[model samples]
Target: MTDATLDRIAGALAGMVLGDALGVPGELWPREKVRSRFGRIEEFLDGPADNIVACYFKAGHYTDDSAQAFVVLEALLKAGTVPPAKTLADDLLEWVRSMNGFEINLLGPSSKASLLAWSKGEDAEAVTKLSLTNGAAMRIAPVGCLVEANEHEKLAETVARVSRVTHSTDVAISGAAMVAQAVASAVAGRSWDEIRTDIAAIHPIALVKGEPTWAASVLARLEAFEAMVEKLGDAPSEEDVSLLIYRAIGTGTMTSESVAAALAVALWCRDPWLAAVMCANMGGDTDTMGAMACAICGAKCGISGMDESVVKYLETTNGIDFRALAKRILEARANFTIGD
Candidate 1:
C-alpha cells in the first residue's frame, strides 16, 4: 500500500477510537436528554453520570467497541488468514477477562451472554443464535482495514466467521459485512456513492450466513435512510439530518438500526469530525454508531484530513499508538488472504 493508503488506515484506526471517546459521554440517552446535558457535544467530555456503562470511563476513553476491534486485529494477525471463530472467541474471552469486562459492565447484552456461554463450555455456534445486536458491526471495521473491497465473497465469509464468535444472526452478520466492506472500499479510494453501492451488493451475501432472526433487514433500513435524505432536501444542516435519523432510522443497539444509521450519517456528514459529533449528539448507543460512522469518514479523509485538535486529544488520552497499529496492519494486509 502507498503512504496515502497507510494514512487512511491510520486515520480509520484513530477515527473509530475518537468516535467512541467523543460519544461515550452521551451514550444510551435520548436525543432530548443528550441535548439537555451536553448541548452540541463538540469536545470530549466525561461520560454522564446517568450512563451506567459510560460513567465508569473518563473523558476520551474508548469503550468495548475499539477494544473488541483490537481483538479482531490481534486474531487476524495470529491466524495469518481469515480468523477462525474459535480463535476469535479465545481472543475475545482473554480481552474481556483482562479488562474485567464482566464485572465492569462494558460488554453489550449479546456479547456478554455469548462470551459467558463460551466461557462455560457452551457450544460456540449454538450460543450465537440470539445475538442480534450491533456488537459484531461495532468492531468489524478492522476487517475492512485488512481486506480489500473487491474480495466481496471472501470478505462476507470472513465477516461471518468473525461475527459468529459473538453475533451469528443474519442481521448481525449482514451489518458487520456492510461495515467491514465499507471501510475496505474507503481504504481502496472508492467514493462515498460507490462505497454505499458496494454495501448493497454485499448485504445479501452476508445475510446467507448465521442463524435466522426476525429483525429488520439492514438493506431496507439503508433505503429508508436514502428516502429520509431525499425528504431532507439539499444541503441540510448536520443537526437536521441527525434528528431525522434519530426519529426515523434509529440509533440503538440493534445491528440493522445502528449500523445503517452510522453508514447514513457518515455519507451525509462526509466530514470525519462532524460525523462523530453528530452521532455523539444524536444519542442512543452513540459510541457505537459514532465509531462506525467516523471510521468510514476517516477512511475517506485520512489522518491529515481530520480535525487536528481532536486527533491530538484522541492520541494523547488513549494509550494506543494508532500509527504503529496501522503499520502492523499494513504489514499483515498483503500476506493474509480470506478464503472462499
Candidate 2:
C-alpha cells in the first residue's frame, strides 16, 4: 500500500514487458548467432526475417510469455483475487481457443497441447499433468506480486491454483512457485539473500499425482545454478555469463533449464537491466528467461532503476499500461488481505 511498495510492483511488471520485448529478436537464436546478428542486444531489435515465430511479431513486441502473463493478470483483476481452479481453467481454455483460431502469434507447445486436450473434454488435471515447460513460470509474476510481502504462504497457494490450470506437474508448479515466492519477497523489500532462501525453501504441491522424478531433475538444475553463480562470482563479464548460461546452465524452454537459467542470472546481477541483457545474450528461450530474471531484479531495483528510454519505447510499442496493471493488482491484494 505504501508508495515504495507500489513502485516495486510497477517496476516488476514493467520489467516483464521490457524483458519480453527486448528478448524477442533473439528468442531462438544461438549465442553465436545472436552475437553475430546483434552484437550484444542492449536495445529492442526486430525479429530476423528467417525466424517463423519471431518474424510474425515486430520489434518491441512481446510473445506468448507476456501475453499469457497478461491473461493471468486479467483473470486476477476479474476475480479481485486468485480465482478458483475451474474458473481459472475456463479462462485459460478460452485463451487457447481464441489463439488457436486467430494466430498472429504462436503458443508454446506445453500450453497449447494441454489446453487442446482440455478443449476435447479431457480431464483438466490430466491435460496439465503432461506439461513440464516454463510456460507456467513465465506467467506467474503477477501472482507473486499480488499478495502482501509477508504473505509468502498465500503467494504459494495462489501459485498452485493458477499453475494447475495449465501446469499440474510437481516440477512445473515448483518452478513457478519459486519465482512467485521470490517476487512476493522482493516486492516486500527482502534482500537478495532473503529472497533466495525463500525460493529455495518452497515445496511443490502434489496436485492429484506428483512428478518426483521430474522434480528431482529440476532440483539438480537449481543446485547447479547456485554452484555456478558462486563459482563465477558477482559481476562476471558478459561473455563469461553468457557462456555459462548457454553451455552449462542452458537456455531451454523446459522448466529445468529456463528456471535455473533465470534464477542464475538474477543471482549474479543486481541491476534489472543488466540481468535482462545478460539473459538476452545467452539466446535460446531468451524472452522467458529474460522476463523471469528481470522481474526479480526489477522488484529489487524499482521502476526508477529501469532505463527511461527503454521503458518509454516498451510503452509506446506494446501499448501496455504496466503501471496501471500493477496498481490494480496491488489494490486487489490489499482487498484480499484486509482481514488477514
Give all candidate RMSDs, comma-separated: 1.3, 2.7
Model 1: runs farther than 4 Å from truth? none
User: Which candidate has the highest lDDT of all?
Assistant: 1
Clashing pairs in 1: none
Error of 2 at 312 (Å): 1.8
TM-score of each: 0.97, 0.91
Please, what is the whole-model Cα lDDT of each candidate in the order they appear?
0.87, 0.77
Regions more than 4 Å wrong, model 2: 96-105, 204-211, 215-219, 233-235, 337-340
- Candidate 1: tens digits of C-alpha lDDT, residues 45-106: 88777788798888898889998998888888877786667777888999999988889878
Q: State candidate 1's TM-score.
A: 0.97
